[model samples]
Target: MDTATHFAMGFGLAGLAYLDPVVASTPALAGAVMIGTVIGSQAPDLDGLVRLRGTAAYVRNHRGVSHSVPALFLWTGAIFVLIQAIMPQAHWFHLLSWIFLAVCLHVFVDLFNSYGTKGLYPFRDKWVALNAIFIFDPFIFAAHLVGFLLWASGVDPGRSFLLIYIIIAGYYYWRVQVQKRMTELVRQRIGKTGTYTIIPTLSWTNWTFVAKTEHHWYVGELISGEVIILDTFTIKPENERIAAAKKSFKVQSFLAFTHHVHVETKERPFGYEVKWIDLRYRSRFQGKSHYMFVAVVYLDFDLTIRDSFVGWIHRGEDQLAKKLDSNRQLS
Candidate 1:
């Protein structure tokens, strides 16, 4: 998620949680609580890039160390010790207490959906995930929006929005096993027979698999049993990578993603750029190129914009080689 979205969610949580009785009487308390909560929401993301080792990769897929319960306690104690002790004027326990609640609420809210949480800190082996929903679902977002609006209007309803999300997230969580089984069946068939390659399309609602062979791309809705075949995309993983070769795709697989992706280049002496036409469309599901694809790889000597991966070619501007100015007349 982008920083803006995260901040907005944080603000909403803080503003709305004020409506709850525990936080209503004290604005200062709510402020500290909200601060703790929002930070907790993002705390798990710290270990996102850290791969302890290749050994824990499976459970660590989307479910990693940050999502682990150990992580929660680890962070809690750290936060408590740091903030509670550093600020001596305020009662360490008073502030620490609210912050702890805020952090816990943040994690629970994230627990629902397929991106499960490691709720049981030291004992639980599996994660608590509501697989029915996608990690970034618009529907879930809509619900949050409503909650935020209601909270803004000085209405907390004494109901914990975080708790509500858990219940709803749980409903979807239960359905994930069915989809998991379906994915396992496909994984087995393709894994052994050497017939197809599966691509995981992490959608907001559910996990969709795109199995590709040499000739066709088999799109299957894991839970819906809806399958479609397309000739553009390769069924095999090898070709699939080639088929989905845009630079944007590469930028997306980050420990975390930020929406404000901007590219800038400085003016240089003897600015030079070389570009060409190799036609390519957005969706190459079919295994054939219709002379409409082009890869314009340009070499720029300027350090200001050395190796910018221009994911798209609109008209005349090469994504990287083009001057950074938006109003400099499209040439």
Candidate 2:
């Protein structure tokens, strides 16, 4: 989920905390819990500061360690200690409880989205994306927004948020069913020769589908139960050129973070420009060009990496040339 949604969820949780008799009895303690909840909600994303070093560092570690199981306890304890240090008179039990819930909820809700967290880090160093929800879900955001408004208008926030959460839980359950149906449809249409990755989009009926067999790669869209093949490419995992290209640091870093990698090599005047794209994030530009999360590596005549960048880029020769030129100069 996005930052705004996480923050709103934290606030909603704080509203629901009012149902606790301990919190309702003390106004000062309730205020402390509210502040702690809001901060704990966004603290996990503090790893985003790694982008200051570079996008590659950010990509490799943003949610990698911070959203792990150990980090959940770490964030909760750290926030609890800080709040206690600032307000010694406040009730520690109520404040810490909400803070812990806020931090746990932040990591838990993130598991529902396509860009998921490495929540089981030390135990399992793998990205676990459910692909049931979009990164930015308007429905979830609006539901929380309405609850916040109602709380501000003198409505009993505890009951209102509790009811809202029940509905949100049902929404998630329905999305899971939709995702399962879509996956079954893709499996039936494509046969069982290859592995399929079905990623849900903003619309409930639309999905981005990718399949990789022993010899080919299939990229398409599933709309309203119909499978539409947008493009197909031959897979050559044993090719010398691709093998050499994967040795680049940029490709390795990208591979660490993404699941489905689509590599394309183009010969340029300087060298072979190898582009590694994460197929899970397919989006259109101007209703014509297709773009995905990409990382580009320029290898010289001897296959030495000359320059590289890891982030979004236009998927056109001219645009790529311009980006490469800019990257080279910056390097």
Candidate 3:
């Protein structure tokens, strides 16, 4: 989820806290709980500070260990102590419990989106992306807004958010089933030799998918349950250039964050340009399609990395080239 949606979810969780009888009656505790919920909701994303170091660091760390099982309890305990010191009148157990729930819900909802968290880290390093929901879901955000409006209009906050959450729960189930159906459609068309990654778009009936078979890769679109292959690439054995490009930290970080990775190498005037793309996301600009997440590495004739970048490319190769040129540093 995006930052705004996460903050909205925090307020939604605070509203749900009204279900507690003790919290409902005490204004001081209710205020304390709201603060705790908001903080706990945004805590795991503290890894976002890595962006200050660089995109490579951000890619390698954001939502990695911070969203793990151990970080959940750490966030809860830390927030509880902070809020407790501020509001000594607040119930210790209730404050701790609500903060815990807030952090848990934050990680749980993140699993539904395309950019998933490493929630099972230490136990497993795999990224758990359900690909069911977009990062910023309007329906979920609107529900929280409606709950706030209803509460301001004299409606019971507890009952209002409870019903909202129930509906949201149902919405999640429907989205998950829709993703499953899209995956099935891709499998039925592709014959299911290898793995398929289906990514949902804003439209309910539209999706993007990548199918990796033993010999080739299939990139396509799913429209109204129909599978349309837009492009196909043969899976080639890794050569020396590809191995050399992976030595760059930018390339390594990009590869670490993506599952359906596709590498392309091109000869350049000075050296070679190796581009690593995550096939999971596809975008269209002016009717032409483009891969979204990418890492570009410039290697010399001797395979030494000279310059590199790991991030999204929006405007196209022209703009990207300009960016790389402006930042290029020779080793």
Which of the two candidates, 2 or 3, achieves a greater lDDT against the reference?
3
Predicted structure with the largest lDDT when compared to the true one? 3
Distance (Å) between predicted and true CA of 231, model 2? 1.5
Task: Give the TM-score comparing model 3 with the true structure, all chains together.
Answer: 0.96
Task: Report RMSD (Å) for each prediction in the order shown.
Answer: 11.0, 2.2, 1.8
User: Quick one: ranking by TM-score, best first?
Assistant: 3, 2, 1
lDDT of 1 by residue, 40-102 (tens): 556656665544532123324444556566666777667666654544325445555555554
Off by over 4 Å in 1: 1-22, 48-63, 85-131, 160-167, 170-207, 210-219, 222-225, 229-331
lDDT of 3 at 289: 79
Where does the lowest 10-residue lDDT sum fall in candidate 2? 322-331
Query: How far off is residue 228 in model 3, in Å?
Result: 1.8
TM-score of each: 0.47, 0.93, 0.96
Name the lDDT of candidate 2. Answer: 0.83
Task: Determine the backbone clash count of candidate 2.
Answer: 0
Q: C-alpha displacement of 49 in model 1, angstroms? A: 6.8
lDDT by residue for model 3 (105-146), tens: 899999988899999887998889899998888899999999
Cα error of candidate 3 at position 99, Å = 0.7
Query: Clashes in each model (backbone N, CA, C under 3 Å)?
Result: 21, 0, 0
